[model samples]
Target: MTALRSRVAETARVYRLHPPRVSLGRVVATPGALDVVRDHGVDLPGLLRRHASGDWGDVCAADAQANDLAADPACPARLLSAYDTAGGRLWVLTEADRSATTVLLPSEY
Candidate 1:
C-alpha cells in the first residue's frame, strides 16, 4: 500500500479497542498535529470540523515558521481513513503499538 494507505490501515487496526479523548478544533496547526489524528483514528471530515471550529492561523502558522513535518501534504491525508472505528486518539495508537508486534507507527513521520 501507499504511505497514506499504510497509515490508514494501521490507524484502523489500532483504534478498534481504544478511543480518543480530545479532537483539536483548530485549522492553523501543523500537519503533524492533524496527522496525530490519523495516528489516532479520526477521519478527514471530523478533522475539518475540528479545524473549522478553531483557529486555522494559530494551528498552521507555527508549522510554516518551523517547517515541521506537520506541514507535509501526506500527513493530513494519511490520518484520515475508513478504519477510524474509534476516535483514534494519538496516545491510544501509541499504546496499541507497544502492545502489538508491528511497527505500524512509521518513524519517518
Candidate 2:
C-alpha cells in the first residue's frame, strides 16, 4: 500500500480496559495504518492533542493509555470507540459526523 513494507497482521484489534472490558470493530486498523493517515497530512497526533474533537467529545488519550483488543470478540461493529476513561460507556461512530451508539452487554449470561 505504501513504499514502506507493511507489517503482517499476525494479530489486530481495538481495545480499552481500566476495568477489564472488551470492544470490537471490523475495520480494525493498526497504529501503522494510522501512521499512513498521518503521512497524508492528517494531524493524527492532533487527536492526542485535544481531549475531544468539535462537539463530538472524543477524548484524546496519551501513549500510556493505549491498549490492544485484537483477539477480543466483544463488539463486532464497523468502528471502535471509547470514553478514554470508561469502558462501560463504550461507543462506535457508525457514520461520519453522526452521533455515537452505545455498546450494550446482554445481562442474560
Candidate 3:
C-alpha cells in the first residue's frame, strides 16, 4: 500500500476501536479539497477520523476546547479541525446539526 493509504488504514482501525464523539451524518469534499487530494495526496479519511475522534488536529487550544464542547452530540455548535498538507492547510468541518461534514481548503472557508 502507499504510505498515505497505510496511514489512513491505521487511523481508520484506531478510530474503529473507539466510538466517534459525534456523528458525521454525511461526508463531502469541496472542489479545493479534491484538488489538494489530487495534488498533495492529503488523507481526507484519516483527517476525518481524527476529527471525529476529537484529536482536533492543528487547532489552537481555545479552538480545540471549543471543538470538545461541540463534540458532544447535544451541543449545537460546529466542529472544526485543521491539518497541514503538502499543498497547504486543510480543514474538516462538521456542521452544528451534524447533517454534513466537509473537507475543504482554509481559503474556501
Q: Which residue pairs clash within candidate 2? A: 12-70, 13-70
Q: Write the per-residue lDDT of candidate 2 for residues 2-27, one digit (tens) a residue.
A: 32212111111111112223322222
Model 1 lDDT-worst window of ten: 94-103
Clashes of each: 12, 2, 0
lDDT of 1 by residue, 39-73 (tens): 65556443333222221212235433332232233
**Evaluated with TM-score, which candidate comes out highest?**
3
List the candidates' TM-scores in order. 0.23, 0.20, 0.81
lDDT of each: 0.33, 0.27, 0.84
Query: What residue runs in model 3 are displaced by over 4 Å at the alpha carbon?
Result: 1-17
How much is the lDDT of residue 37 in candidate 3?
Answer: 91
